[model samples]
Target: MELIQEVMIMYCTRNVTEDLVWVGGNDRRLSLFEGVYKVPYGVSYNSYLLLDEKTVLLDTVDKAVGGIFFENIEHTLNGRPLDYLIVNHMEPDHCAMIEDLTRRHPETVIVTNAKVAGMIKQFFNFDIDSKLKLVSEGDELSTGKHNLTFIMAPMVHWPEVMVTYDKTDRIPFSADAFGCFGAINGALFADEVDFYRDYFDEARRYYTNIVGKYGAQVQALLKKASAVEISMICPLHGFVWRRDFADYIAAYDKWSRYEPEKQGVVIAYGSIYGNTENAAEILACRLNELGIRTKMFDVSVVPASEIVAATFEYSHVVFASATYNGGIFVKMEDLLHDLAAHNFQNRTVALIENGTWAAMTAKQTAELLGKCKNLNILEQKVTIKSSVKQAQNEDIDALAKTIAGTF
Candidate 1:
């Protein structure tokens, strides 16, 4: 006699381990992430469900996809009641569905730190104290067969942020430490996709904008993480790192230490007319002629997030802008503010300013870049009067040489 097999349906859910499943969904329809940066490739909200002795759900999804998330949880649980819900980060993108989850599984205990617990109250009017089980650093929560250790990672982008480490699987549920801003379309693990080709830029943008402000905190977390054995990194966003852990860790180390990942030049210019842009193009050509690689971006066109990422990636950065209202161009000023706010450091920067009369952009740009640490502002400031004249070519060449010498 032949037996019939009962096939189970999974709605965008994948298994991380025999007892652990990925119960997260992607937000491809949302135009902006946090109403600030553009996510052209979309983003993912990663949450894992561990079906151990105690069925545990780690983190919730944004309210936009709350329905799909609940469906995923139901399908994965297969009618089993939820025992615990671990809150890694209190950001609404990860905690918007907390009240909904508690309503669905009233018996499930919400686990998090005291600071995050307070944030939960501020964001929502839920009775957190009634169901909250606060865990401190070095605290452990044992589920039937798996044990998770909490590591406090304060100012890792947030004051209440913390990571959960599963001792049995040696996986760290990093809240936002190793996260990126791209949707996981079919491929869930880093090795499953062409990471460098597909998600490297987005990952850099995510890191530089979201967590770049707290490099010291990240360094401290890395030191603490080195003491433990981490084989797999399952962050709250983007792909899971099941292979090449060292490469990713090293990248994070370099990024947190404000070190450039490559030797190249990034030319960012804000031009009202084509004159300023023309000067920028000329400089880029000169840099290329000298065998120095360059990445050029028009500040008015390209997003500031990309420029910030490029500034972090390259060893040299050139800010070329046309004077507007006797000051630096607004878009260029905004980009510089972002770079300084993100604590951009350890790079050689050159200034190129254009003005018909009263050229004050160079001075203003210098003052802005001066706020940053370890920035080597080149002495040769290329000043374009109305347009790039034949006399300025020598100055541009000198500036190019100064920049190339550093490489």
Candidate 2:
């Protein structure tokens, strides 16, 4: 007699929508707050297993976690062989395990768009065309009960990116459009997890860090998504959204639009000495007194990723920096560059410069911000004179008033 592990039957994968499924991937906890870069709260190499008589596996996990992904697929299939493997994005993390999966199931046919086929050959060196079913943007794959419709999502974080929607189930399995790091423990669906406690911030972090540069393209993608009558969003990673899924979609739209979230102030300051720091603190307190919510971020200490993430949360941004060699501080420069690359739109930005002799951070930051369309800069700038003085305190207060009034 052969020993067997406990069998797992899945109605649908945890993080996926209806006919689409989220089979595996996502780390827990680390993606919550900030600490390090390169290694995000761990990452989930999400894959989906779509079962409807003739089974299809959408994407594969990273090679490092291939074994786990196989386990999830096997558990879902219950010994049923995979008939098709759809390649949505060819990023190594999502496609690394494809070779392994194909080796196990030689009969599986690979389906993908033309550009993705080239990527597969470049990375895997396999002649996929012979066994590949090339599909277009509106191609459909029927699996008895579900009809999977493919939509092209160019520059939606990647050039070869695409999404699959199941009309029968009213679910969309977006490749990475709404993905986030951090696992939702055992909870499978979006409604099962605590959105306020877990999913909200991480989703913003993922968007800002990974796909911030493609804000305009995202707006177009959202318009495309609107055409579909979707009730659930099963992204590649994180939990599946089954109930009130529109809320998540709306949130993504707002962030990508670079619209402000309520009336609040974000003070991101980078100070070599304590002078700029003092200015930021004063600004925070002054804003508080005006009955406005204020959040402070030390650019030197805060990860650029977190600062990017926070941009999606607040309406107004107050950038305070000490001048370094007649320019913005290095950290502040990096933050501004990242923000500008994302086409920071709709938000109001205020500047605070601290320099003993040449006050350059304010001018430089303003010039950099000018490149971003629709970014409103406060006319009144708070200049800290090397040291915190009584006069500087008044300037900070006035700056706070401008931010509050803009709201």
Candidate 3:
């Protein structure tokens, strides 16, 4: 059977290869992904169906697109019974349709690891014990032409996670290792779209905010991947990587190592009456004037997650906050804590604090940043009394030059 050749991002069925078809769907109506990150462009729940001597479904989509997903399966299978249902990761977005899919294809055998088998019992009430086919690291499953080898990838954000390698097509069915946060509305492959322009920010945000803390685990996974000869990467979300994807993989290497992709500055500040913001703006202007790339955000307006992601992108971060009752401003405090929680490390930091009487946010914010690892705080801190004073303006100039010189 031939598949549709039209390229679109809607809930449409398409072919991934001669033996495989994409039976996934996108949700534009979804406002916030996981009730946290704002998805103005929405996100995708990807699933693939393989048709060989015995048919196999790689994974299931989020429950939001259950109707479209099942429709795609019915259309792709064309009445052929599903022989195997592979569970790459047990995350809710990728595993929500398991029970329903099994019920529709009652004879489909689930191929997963031992950990995911226990998770199945917790997520659904079906008789998984009878239909479960457990695999371990380096375990291979033959579906006529394609041989899938499973690699254990525990704590790559989840305890029960793994990725599959197809020997026939040289493709890796990565669970969430290379995925992003945006929907696939046009091109399915990263090489087909302007990936760096459209999806790069979301990809950084997805990794830094969602999977940032698991650098060691991701590093371990990358080491395992190096052992195989991969021609393409089909992750559970975002676009597939067929060609010109070395940069993305290299980025994962850097990100997993908690290394910056670029040497620049990202300034995030909290202000009560705009005094701290004023200080931040001055620093940003001076830094850019000195030929240091700068990105500025106000904690009161921009999302903390975005700021956290920015911190991951650049080598330097400037934390400026107006002192509130002898403490760091509420929003700045939260933003700093968020960065620390995401396992932020190996970056230089500069401080700027504004207070009418007792300027203490520079010290307080430093205390919070101290919770992170390998941070280099600059000795040249800037303090403002309610606003940027005449002498304090000179202090800002010195601090900006020191930050710019680090590059």
Best by lDDT: 1
- Candidate 2 — worst ten consecutive residues by lDDT sum? 29-38
Candidate 1 TM-score to native = 0.97
Supply candidate 3's per-residue lDDT for 337: 81
Candidate 3 segments whose C-alpha is farther than 4 A from its true place: 1-11
Model 2: per-residue Cα lDDT over 1-407, one tens digit each:
99989865434245354445567755443443324443344666667788787998888876666666777787787788899998888887688887778888888999889888888988886557777999998899998888888999988888988888878888777888888766556676667778857667777888877777888888888998899897777777777677876777888888887776667888999998788998899889989999999888998888777888787788888899999988899999999998887667778889999999877888889988888888888889988769789898888888888888887
User: What is candidate 1's CA lDDT for residue 47?
Assistant: 93
Candidate 3 residue-wise lDDT, 265-323, digit = tens: 99998989888888899999999899889999988989887998898899999999888
TM-score for all models, in order of appearance? 0.97, 0.91, 0.96
What digit string (tens of lDDT, one per residue) describes model 1 on residues 52-162?
889999999888878879889999999999999999998989999999999899999999999999999998887879998999999999997899999999999899999
> How many residue pairs collide in each prediction?
0, 4, 1
The global Cα lDDT (0 to 1) of model 1 is: 0.92
Question: Which residue ranges in model 1 land beyond 4 Å of their true spot?
Answer: 1-10
Clashes of 3: 1
Residue 364 local lDDT, model 2: 88
Please give the range of 10 consecutive residues that has the lowest summed lDDT in model 3: 7-16
Once fitted onto the true fold, the runs of candidate 2 whose alpha carbons sit more than 4 angstroms away are: 1-22, 27-41
Tell me the lDDT of candidate 2. 0.80
